[model samples]
Target: MNKPCFLLLCLVANGLFPVYAITPGQTEKENPMTINMSINQQTYEISLSDTAAAKAFVEQLPLTLNMEELNGNEKFADLAHSLPTRQSRPGALHAGDLMLYGHQTLVLFYETFQTSYSYTPIGKVIAPEGLKKAVGDKNIAVHFYRD
Candidate 1:
């Protein structure tokens, strides 16, 4: 085993530490960060991905952005600052998939589609059934905050 994990095992075996089993897509933290995405008076809860970029995005939150429309499928806004990135090609994008493009651009997809671009995952909106309608056909004002 790796050194840190072996050390943890030893500590647990000696009754000096408690073990917590983290499930897939979960972190060791007691609580995952959640935020709200408000668009056109409709609110959606966002469960942030466990990533350094996501945490950095949260640090700049309580933000209002005028997101510009693109390709009839997504909205994007350029952030005042850049976040760390671990970019990957997800291949297929889903509605309510929040992502960062090139460390500085924030993107929210409102339609399911295939793509060749790479992006850093941010978070996903829970229950995104009406998301497409809420985002509409043009530029939009989106408010993000923690509560």
Candidate 2:
């Protein structure tokens, strides 16, 4: 092939050609948000985006997670249990409220058995909609409790 034709073919093969590409129904996964939940006085840190982190944190706790219907409108009471002594206040240490840190944004949500709290972090591709749905908004006030 001629030098010009060869160059053109190379450009096309290399995807250097300006082609209008439209990605539909493609939503980027939101950045990982750190949520600190205190159950029985032990602070359990987790990232909703990281399944491994969530699993590891849950495994270390004596509390069994009822993630069966994890979504909005779920209640913490429905999933609460008497954690084993190894995971309780004297055993594992837990924080007071659920602290979420994401993209320079820190959100604290109180746990409740009703409603949902909505959150939108700046520059975050994914919103904590699932969490809001699971935790509910009833105990979502920005108030901190000392145990």
- Best model number under lDDT: 1
Candidate 1 local accuracy as lDDT?
A: 0.94
Candidate 2: segments with Cα more than 4 A from true spot: 16-41, 48-110, 116-147
TM-score of model 1 vs. true structure: 0.82
Q: State TM-scores per candidate.
A: 0.82, 0.26
Least well predicted 10-residue stretch by lDDT in candidate 2: 84-93
Q: 36-67, model 1: which lDDT tens digit per residue? A: 99999999999898889999999998999999
TM-score of 2: 0.26
- Model 1 clash tally, residue pairs: 0
